[model samples]
Target: MSKIVLYWHPMSSATPIACALAELGVPHERVKVDIHAGEQRKPAYLALNPNGKVPTLTVDGAPMFEALAIHLWLAGQYGVERGLWPAEGTPERLQAMAWSTWSYVTYGAQLVRLQTARDMGTPDDPHGQAGHKAMDELLALLDQRLASQPWMLGANYSMVDLIVGSVIGYSAYIGAPVQKHPHVLAWLGKVQARPAMQIDA
Candidate 1:
């Protein structure tokens, strides 16, 4: 077994990575970086991740950063063996990669705009309205996909579901009006019900 250490902070983007680790049931070490205290910006942490973000993983002393990249790598390395990742060179694998990327790249982009607008207390502004519109379109796409299948990659649950679901769930948490999409709400409920998805806030 590789020596895996996860550097994380509470209630951040790192939460999803922690959830993934739990689902995989991998034995690893957890190091909390107190972003509130600026620990993430310290030189020691920056050496491992110049981005100076939480949720950096060290596998046998080699560091990897970025929440999405870490999730993909973990799914490939640990999740494949645990039946939480699709096999390599398969259509399901391709779909997994695509949907996972869409969750972050396509959906996450609009979500950020919405969040920024909300943080600035101008959620009713044109920028916020645009973000909401884009998000609704994206949610409709997700709803259509879930209407045909139980999970993201079909019948069985996988890391793709976790990855996509987490992003959508975060949007809903931040007031994205996700309840309007029934199919998406239902699918997200199922994903969230997993024991491994539970985390301390």
Candidate 2:
């Protein structure tokens, strides 16, 4: 087994990775980087992740960063055997990859914008409005996808649901209009109810 070490902080973007680790039952070391204390910018942590971000994982001492990349890699590497990830080269795998990327690139981007607007106390501004609209449309798309299914990749809850659901759950927590989409809200509730999602990491 490869020795894995996770560098993370509490309640930040790294939480999802921690949750994934828990779900996979992967035994690893955890190093808490206090971002509030600016430990992330220190030279040692920067050596692992030049972006100076948490959620950096070192597998056999080789470092990898970014929550999306880490999640996908974890699912591919460990999730297949556990049924958390779809097998490669299949339609379900393709959908999993697509939705996973969409969660980060598409929905996550708009969520950041909305968060920025709110942080600036300008949620009613044009940029904020645009972000809100984009989020609504994205959530509607997710809603439609879930209208007939309970999970993102269909009947079973897989890593795809966890990946996308984490972002959607965070959006709702940060005051996104996720409540407007009933299917999404319901699906998110299911995701959150998982024991892995309940881990405080």
TM-score of each: 0.97, 0.98
Per residue, candidate 2 scores C-alpha lDDT tens digits across 1-201 of 899899999999899999999999899999999999999999999999999988899999999999999999999999999999999889999999999999999999999899999999998899888999999999999999999998998899998988998999999887789999999988899899999999978
Candidate 2: deviation at residue 140, Å?
Answer: 0.5
Q: Listing every candidate in turn, what is its Cα RMSD in Å to the true structure after a full C-alpha superposition?
A: 0.9, 0.7
Candidate 2 deviant stretches above 4 angstroms: none
lDDT of 1 by residue, 1-106 (tens): 9999999998998999999989899888999999999999999999999999888999999999999999999999988878889889989899999999999999
What's model 1's overall lDDT? Answer: 0.92
Query: Candidate 1 regions off by >4 Å?
Result: none
Flag clash pairs in model 1. none
Best of the candidates, lDDT: 2
TM-score of decoy 2: 0.98
Model 1 earns a TM-score of 0.97
The 10-residue segment of model 1 with minimum total lDDT is: 192-201
